[model samples]
Target: MKLRELRIEKGITHKQLSDDIGVPVRTISRWEKGESDMLLKNAIKLAEYFEVTLDEFINF
Candidate 1:
């Protein structure tokens, strides 16, 4: 899924969510821009933080 959708659906800003999950804001931007892939650890953290499954996060 696209980062824009995830961020909007989770009601979080890139900076805020990244900070909450101990990642860099730039990395989040890269993910949004398709410049990087999500790491499994970060994906798990995001799912927990957003109360979603990895499939949901990936919008599968």
Candidate 2:
């Protein structure tokens, strides 16, 4: 997933993202690390947060 890349590009820490999006920091970490799958709702939230389409968020 492009989670880590996008987060870095946006210059935001995982904690900052978690606080803004109401996700747990660990969950964000897991998603970034490919250790777990994000729920669709959470994925949508992230896509919206990053201002990207879902396909770009997940695959680009």
Best by lDDT: 2
Q: How well does candidate 2 score on lDDT at residue 19?
A: 100
Q: What is the lDDT of residue 23 in candidate 1?
A: 91
What is the lDDT for 59 in model 2? Answer: 84
Question: What is the number of backbone collisions in each predicted candidate, taken in the order shown?
Answer: 0, 0
Model 1 lDDT, full chain set: 0.82
At residue 25, candidate 1 shows an lDDT of 94
TM-score of 1: 0.81
Model 2 over residues 10-58: C-alpha lDDT tens digits? 9999999999999899999998888999899988899999999998887
For model 1, how does the per-residue alpha-carbon lDDT over 1-60 read when each residue is reduced to its tens digit?
666786887688988988898999999889889899988888878777777788887783
For model 2, the superposed segments whose C-alpha errors exceed 4 Å read none
Residue pairs with clashing backbones, model 2: none
**Any idea how many clashes model 2 has?**
0
Q: How do all models score by TM-score?
A: 0.81, 0.93
